[model samples]
Target: MNVDRRRRRIVVVGGGVAGVEIATSLGRRSKNDQSMPAVILVDRDSAHIWKPMLHTIAAGTRDISQQQTPYLAQARDAGFEYQPGEMCSLNRANRTIGLAPLHAPDGRLLVPAREIAYDTLVISVGSEANDFGTPGVQEYCFKIDSRLQADAFNREVRIRMLQSVAQEQDLSIAIVGGGATGVELAAELMQLTQIAEAYGAPALSSRIRITLIESGPRLLPAFPDDISQATEERLESIGIRVMTNSKVSAATTEGFELDDGPTVTASLKVWAAGVKAPAFLTNLDGLESTRGNQLVVLPSLQTTQDPNIFSLGDCSSLTLSQGERPLPPTAQVAHQQAQHLIRHLPAVISRGKRPPDFNYRDFGSLVSLAEYDAFGSLGKYGLFKGTTIRGRLAQLSHAMLYRSHQARLYGFWRGSLVWMVDRLNMRLRSAIRLD
Candidate 1:
């Protein structure tokens, strides 16, 4: 079988960090080799924004437009076809997937239901907040799962601030969850309050209050104990209340109902807790999956039931033979997996060869607490081991991660231009978004 002689169609569903990298890399690779597969990148949105920055956007400290990459532009620059739609179903027998109809904000139909065929498929649609069937969560809490959601949250904050200033009333916000997303949001929200005051809202800082509620015994439970302790203390110093081991059994119109019968009241509520894949994925074509609905994949990232289908990032679960737990869902994990596929996918598709097992390299995690403080442990691959960094050094390392990501997607000169523009914007514009 001369696999390289055939024209292969590769369709990637999702435009996340992993999906964009794989699609762009594959498209570029195929351009030089006529025998390689043709790539199509399908996503619900026409633009891509790094998920980790959602908290900053929600806090109004970051502008969404400046950070987002338009998908059509990306395709034109990277040599791939861009299809915009939501993936609704998978047909294994026919090797095709169904996309739901696209609609406009005014309830007008834009695109009809369609199906796309693929010789190979990659699923990278990321996870969403897991409410665990908690009552009122869906109805009451604001979430930061998508770019639109983050923007909406910030807009609401601005509206509420205006009303509070007119009425001379204090505004209260309560966030549920102690994980990275929740912690980062709490810090950023405080920073937003400070910036808001600087913009001439004299009493805004003192009139706004933030309370972080965590079900766990400590914040950032994934990090070292000392780091978590330091983070809590820093948050406390900023006038944000930190509540640990305070599980909320239910949410109400007023606020959250604690498990022990106490109630915490707030003007705005946010749920930033656990995460699970989209509900539709659990039943997709009978593929093996974890309880959280993450597709079970082999070490090579191919779905257990279908060799032509693969999954990565937050949507896939792979428990190495030597490990008791699956890899943590993080940007670095997704980026590394995409790199592995870049190296091996061509061999698997073009030469009928096996994909080498992927090995994840962990360099540790960092937490950014707005502009006040940052801390984390950095570790080298082998002999160098671990090094702890705090304050300024940790803050710089955190910023470098996002810059490196931009460099990957935009190339050197373009990425440098973006950095320069961001610096200029910081000096010219107000720190927080007013519009």
Candidate 2:
């Protein structure tokens, strides 16, 4: 297909879930027609993985290999071009972007920084863990914000487990952030110890100490109080200590020192507390941003100052009308925003018009608390006006979120087949604890 013949050129930055979704959808829509716009996906990494699954990888229940999709392969299959490089700056006035130098580990320059022109630029460069300017966090705490960070935490966990086994001592893990990531990681760590013991890792049966620290009064501050209570109870039942109203004043190599001056030492520390837009985004010329440095996007997902530039996922602060608060940085919200853009972009490209306001629909929330089970609220049901499920049902629902995303990218038939295959693979393989 002569995609270049089409006047519209769409450039999507970031290879995470949002970037891939938008690129894939545009490519699929343009497949049999040469008049459709060309799509290019850009990111520093060559592979794409679901950001929501990083916590599971850290806990060692799921191997990172199984969770990642090669960007080259996906681009080829989806009919889009894949470009590997970090974006240095965006120039809305010139309709061009600045690219950073690409280098090899041996210090050889590969691609000299060059500008890429785009009729429409979609900035989906996802957010990173918010340090809140906390002291020692940059040097000490492990964050699961990216695949690299997740891998680092996984390695630390394995090495610590080995050392603990060698010394015949308990393995201690401290997780900061009581949100979904923190709660999920705490549960996954417990499962990892069980899986490790099955694999004959010495002294793995002893008490595994895990502390979940949250600054809020309860876990899952985003969810309803009932759901949060259930999640807290479930964690405590599994012997995972839940500490609410606790703040990490500083992180040391030894462990986290609490605000009240109590030091909690651990073999590993994970920071999942909050998210902030990447620092580079703040410097984008003429773009209005939030306190967290997220690009301030209008209801239509376009930046207020630049209609040609769009952003979604955790990177943009698009507020909802109901609560007058920015939408939570979740996978579902990003997916929904991408779907809206898929429908709206074609018109904007072809007719030289912008779409009307777009609003987000809340699908409730789900939190998977390791193998002891999952708990959260689902929006579809009528019981209590919002049905809350825990245990196996909740687990199935939690798994389905990824499946739902897969279904949207691929069709239902293909997505279902992949899901079944993955389930079977999990059954056959000796579980490798990544956390």
Choose the strongest candidate by lDDT. Answer: 1
Clashing pairs in 1: none
Model 2's number of clashes is 5
lDDT of each: 0.89, 0.84
The numbered model that scores best in TM-score is: 1
lDDT of 2: 0.84
Q: At residue 151, give the lDDT of candidate 2.
A: 78
Off by over 4 Å in 2: 1-6, 105-110, 380-385, 433-435
lDDT tens readout by residue for model 2, 1-435? 234733578999997778899998898766655677888888988787788888888777887877777888777778888888899898888898888989997999988898878999999999888878889888888899888778778888888888888878777889899999889989888888878888887558575699999988999998889988988998888778899998889889888888875888876778889989888888698799888889999888999999989999999998766656788888878888888888899889878898777777776788887778888686643544477778899888889888887786667898888789788879997677533
Q: Write the per-residue lDDT of candidate 1 for residues 226-339, one digit (tens) a residue.
A: 899999999999999999999899999999999985799988999999988887788799898899999999999999999999999999999988789999888889999999
Pairs in clash, predicted candidate 2: 58-435, 59-435, 60-433, 60-434, 60-435
